[model samples]
Target: MRRFYSYLIYKLYTWALNGSGYNTPIFNVIVTLACVHSFQLIFLMFIAFKCLPANTHLSGWLNYVAILAILFLISHYYVFYNKERWEGYVKEFENETPKQSLKGKIYVLSYLIGSTIGVIWLMYFMSVYLFK
Candidate 1:
């Protein structure tokens, strides 16, 4: 998980650096957002299906804030907390074969796309079934 996390951070950091020429803090936030969204889906899905006394509705703003806190911490560990760790990851894959690099990119892209679709589908399902 740490390896993949670093790779994802490196991928997003470089991409954001190229795309918008934003400074480091903005890129850090973008990476943090990606991590938050990835784990937030899992958290929501658990609430969707986990056994409980009853199907309960959470306050929308509260749910958002909780996930923002939990998963954001899980994702970035406070953006500026460990610059050495982030630097270690910055070029961790520099020596990889082209084939391996392509495969890694595919994995990252698939993860992003799958998590996004999962969230969209989960929202629709919740609205139609659970929240009804």
Candidate 2:
């Protein structure tokens, strides 16, 4: 998990550094928002499975999602906005072998793709079951 977090930080920084005029803060926000979509899926599943144990309606879910979004945004920005913090992560993992780097890329890519699909599926399920 530590390695994954570092790699994610590194990748986010590398992207911000490479393109769109070196806007680290903005890119960090964008990347974090993208990842946070998966959090919605987790939240939805928790409610669906009774893990959250909430007795509320769609508006309640939306409120919880809004809070979760704010929390994730602040936390992600806090950890990643510090240059030294992410720079150290980059330095530590920069020496990765080509094979290891490729594996990391594949892992991150697959996770994002799978989570996106999961979110879509869950959203559809909610629309059919909850909205109707």
Candidate 3:
């Protein structure tokens, strides 16, 4: 089960990084969101497995908060180290031609929001099902 879970996470990360049909900026945003969400989920699972009391709801909640803190620290480090790359991506998108159609705009927005929300939902379900 552990190996399968690890493999699944690895595949998801790779897919997030290499997803098609988006510009660099959009891709970066997608990747960042994926990384953040996955990191939080995995960290929470680890904490729950290692530190939390088994069969306790409060412990699970505490594990969640600890995982969030850890993820925030990791995200801060990533943002600090990749500041230039992020800035460049934003600049590139800012200078690019705007999408001309409402459909295009809707598609882009939906893609971003949908993926983020989907990942969050998946993580929530996984945490609840696997840990509880």
Candidate 3 regions with alpha-carbon error over 4 angstroms: 1-73, 79-81, 100-108, 119-132
Pairs with steric clashes in candidate 1: none
Residue 93 of candidate 3: its Cα lDDT?
36
Give the alpha carbon lDDT tens digit for every residue of 1-132 in model 3.
543333333333334446776445434554555555565566556666655565665645877677776776567445434544444433433433444334434554564566567657766776688656
Q: Top TM-score: which candidate number?
A: 2
Question: What TM-score does prediction 2 earn?
Answer: 0.64
Residue by residue across 1-132, what tens digits does model 1's lDDT show? 978877877776666666654677444746555565756656575565454435464647467868766766566545535667656766686687889878988988887776767667766787678766
TM match of model 1 to true structure: 0.62
Clashes of each: 0, 0, 0
Give lDDT per model, in order: 0.66, 0.66, 0.51
Better of 2 and 3 by lDDT: 2
Estimated TM-score for each candidate: 0.62, 0.64, 0.33
Candidate 3, clashing residue pairs? none
